[model samples]
Target: MKHSILLVEDEQKIAEGIMDYMNGGEAEYETCFTWADDGDKALELVYENEYDLVLLDIMLPGADGFEICKAIRAKSYVPVIFLTARGREEDRLYGYDIGCDDYVVKPFSMAELSAKIMSFLRRSKGLWEKKSSIEAYDIVIYPDKLQVFVAGNEVRLAPKEYAMLKYFMEHRGMLITRDDLLVRLWGYDYEGSDRVVDNHIKKLRQALGEPGKKIKTVFAKGYRMD
Candidate 1:
């Protein structure tokens, strides 16, 4: 099937290479590209047209990618990816927090990126179609609403934190290793520090407040949610 992709980048050359691969016959998935040179124009495109996926650059002219990703998440569930030179752990975590579907550092392998793009696209095809809410003690998460409620009060959570809570709810009372989280949430292609999962877990606990105690850390192995 053919997919529509928005390619947002300031550099003329980098965008061209990606576009070439997507448009060229080499890619497994057939895709068409809409190019934007800056963040302002990118947002304009986002508002004006409907795209299946977005390839975003973190450092752009009008608004940075983090802002753009948050805006996109506020409106749509369409996949948004950060393709930038920033490889720092904080940046990657921040991207996940702001609801970016994936983060790819620059000087990257084109083949691997192409593969990841398709992977996200495929996985998100029927994403979040579930309407039922998952509840654990005082914390409740609605997959359809993308909202979290603690003690009957609505509490905002980062995207990654929300996902963690959902996963924990789904596997309550089961041992989930750090490696398990790294693979399940971050994907096998992820190259960031394993500490990212721990960082996210810490923040998720803080978000859940009193109910956070239910997430039991299993020594060095992993965590089990009650």
Candidate 2:
């Protein structure tokens, strides 16, 4: 399904421009731009609807973008990309602090914004459309299907565990560090520690069973699938 998007901007010209850009044939977005003259109206709409993304402007009549962002972050981790004329370093840092996924400065290219939006969506969903299958020794990983077979027998794995194993199978013989696994599988912005990777690895190993060297621990580095 096409993800729904909410755009909250007070300026009519700027809001129309962005809406047009988003609705253009080149842009593959099923977006609903909510042109709110004030933040209060935008916040109300946010509370009323479940949107996949929010494009917020910094300066608004009622609550302001920062306040609205904080309010949204309190309830949801919905992808937020700020669209504003405020290009100050402090404003950027504050936006990031409040969990803004991206900040686009004014006079930015619509094409670039579209690309950024696509990138964020892909990362958020881990939307790997390519169906990939890898066979490493006695283990087989089917990424598209989110299934695994160990020694030709179906073995159940958790979602994250399956992603980890699939990573290993594709990068067989490569010594992947804890950081590498965390970023690739969990996401680059994941706040969790490397211990999460270790825990998931343990689960993956247990699921794969004996001949677990298919997923080998490389001492201080991390893991390798041989």
lDDT of 2: 0.75
Q: What TM-score would each prediction reach against the true structure?
A: 0.62, 0.56
Could you tell me which residue pairs clash in candidate 2? none
Candidates' lDDT values, in order?
0.81, 0.75
* lDDT for 171 (candidate 1): 55
In candidate 2 the C-alpha lDDT for residue 80 amounts to: 86
Best by TM-score: 1
Q: What's the residue-level lDDT of 18 in candidate 1?
A: 95
The window of 10 residues in a row where model 2 has the poorest summed lDDT is 122-131
lDDT of 2 at 197: 87
80-145, model 2: which lDDT tens digit per residue? 889999998668767766767677889789889887776556544322233365666787777657
Candidate 1: where are CA atoms >4 Å away? 128-142, 145-162, 165-226
RMSD of each: 8.6, 9.0
